[model samples]
Target chain A: MKWKLLFELFVVFFKIGPISFGGGYAMIPLIEREIIDKKKWIRSEEVSEVFAIAGTAPGAIAVNAAIFIGYRLAGFLGALAAMIGVLLPTTAIVMLLGSLYFLFKDNALVEGAFLGIRAAVVGLITYAGIKVARTSIIDKPTFILFFLILLSLLFLHLNPILAIFIGALAGILTMTAKKKIQQKREEKTHFQNKQIREISK
Target chain B: MILINLSLLFLFIGVISFGGGFAMIPVIEAEVTKRGWLTTSEYTDIIAVAGMAPGSIASNSATLVGYHVAGVPGAIVSSIAITFPSLILILLIAVSFNKINQSPLFHSIFYGLRPIVTGLILFAAIKFAISNGLIASTFSWQMVILLSIFALSLFVLLYYKAHPVLVILASGIVGAVIFS
Candidate 1:
């Protein structure tokens, strides 16, 4: 890969950073606009491939997407520059907001507003869970996994990370087991059909 | 010492933060809550501030929590720590030309991971509910206010599909009105 045309990469991501209003997903179209539509940094079809990898990767999709594009366009330094550009504005904003919250947190009005916001946050997080669950909890086995994991966290105080590993294991083990069972059943039916045909003969 | 601790913890959080955004909340909640670094209310407040800001909510929360615990250096360390894992992972993938996204093994892993994330987020919601005195063994007036806000927020988010930023802003205003 070519090394270091990183400055232009940095400026593009920096411009793209603040446009992420709703979440990382919302910023995707903008990324599409900048990376594909405007700059033609990568081919249009490859944009989905980039996003798919970005989604599979750990951390925020916006940052991951930027990193992917940067590396493809320039190199290691390009990836680094894009990351800094994406995070630079937002980190400063979070610090500023956080500092202000600390300053005013003691005031009665501020405290009250937080109380309402806190309750609402609970609501929002629940909404997010449900949104994910709509697609995740499709089958009986999945429902069981969902319930078990939730129980483990709430009661057993299982490590959340550990719970995640268990969930992945359960998915693979159960899915593989189901496939094996189906294969065996099909083989048995085939043998039974052969025997019945011979008896008829 | 605190910075070191921040880096290690956030680095781990960064790697496991699959599905991204709110999906990672319970992991952050469990970690910070376990360490007793911040109270549930304080953490909830961090989330609120983070949600209002642009960019990833989880990353922003990490920044706020780090700041709250140990000031600006803490913030920088934690932010970088949370982000570093993915940067390295993607960089390696980009360099290697490995096709992880297209592989069956990777898809199976995510298929399993997704539901677990769903459960974790729900657990986070319940934690907030219980900690804030909203869900008690016995009822109280505080429960009523909390439930009211909770219900309204859910309704707006679900039915109207309002932007989360708007929902948070409205909630803050309501909090100031009622609590003041």
Candidate 2:
């Protein structure tokens, strides 16, 4: 059973490493289908938590998913194996391709091929952004914040790191304000109930 | 000494690269070009090679650059370093995700990040489009055909949910027929 578990982790991640197109974001749905629905290795709630963690933390979402899934399946060693499995195919391909890169380095055909890929890649990135925005930007404040960041990056030529920092700060403040309001409402209700009990006594 | 520094330079590419391979370019250019390890044109060529390679562009480029700067050891270190940030962060997140979910503060941080990430993705798209010669190239009839192919691919992707590989393959065929 242990061996089977290890092999399953290896095979699933190895297959995922190569075929995953559109970089990190697109792999989520496929991972969801395979790991959660089909394999039942993890539940949906856990998948959501993993998604949040993977996106919020650094690195590629796909790699994070591999770590999470591998850790769930096995342990620390499983995470190591899963990382190795996920990286192996891409590494082998890159190393081999890198060696021969200069040979066809200027081949117009290869250039044309990449031109096509770049176009599609652009579309994929745009699609991904739209999807993420649709899911996350629900409220008016968030909607405004999204457009403001876009304008700052486009017209003002502001640095992205600064923009992200500012945005994160805004979110923290907004949530804190909401929390304070809720706390006040709760306190008021408690005070009223105490006064009523005192009057009755 | 310079070569050793170059290895460390590529190591930074691995660490901060979020939003995918494209996001690393500005950061990479700043560090590598500033240090004179690679000229702008050489860096562009490397990017081209990265685009053609089958693996993740950032990883592949880091390995190739590492090899060019030093040797096999450079490649190993750069590759490991580039991937390390993601691996370690994910491991930590995996351990803490369940507990973190209960925190509203965590929720708000993510809520703030969503829009910013979207903005970053859009910025990346614009940058890639310009770099790939999509924007500056003359608007010829060839471009018309290319746009048609792009629109068709987009429609198929949105309306029909056609597999991305097929869309990409078809775009390649269309580009060859028209551009060639």
**lDDT tens readout by residue for model 2, A89-169:** 766666676666556646777556555655665565555566567776889878888888878877787766576677778
Chain B vs. true chain B: TM-score per candidate: 0.92, 0.63
Candidate 1 yields a Cα-based lDDT of 0.86
Model 2 per-residue lDDT at A27? 75
Give the lDDT of residue B163 in candidate 1.
Answer: 89
**Regions of model 1 farther than 4 Å from truth:** A1-4, B95-98
lDDT by residue for model 2 over B1-180, one digit each (tens)?
745675566555555565556555545644666777776445655654554454466776777777667766766677777777777777776777677778888788767767776777666566655665556667766455545655676677777877666766676666655555
Give the DockQ (2 decimals) of all models.
0.78, 0.42
lDDT of 1 by residue, A1-201 (tens): 243367778888888888776477887788778878888888888977788778778889999998888888777778889999999988998899999999999999999888888898899899989998998888888888999889988999888889888988887888788889999999999999999999999
Backbone clashes in each candidate structure, one number apiece? Answer: 2, 1
Candidate 2: regions farther than 4 A off = A1-12, A23-56, A97-102, A178-201, B1-75, B136-146
Q: Ten-residue segment with the worst summed lDDT in candidate 1 chain B?
A: B95-104
Error of 1 at B110 (Å): 1.5
Report the Cα interface RMSD of each model, rounded to 1 decimal: 1.3, 3.6
State residue A54's C-alpha deviation in candidate 1, in Å: 0.8
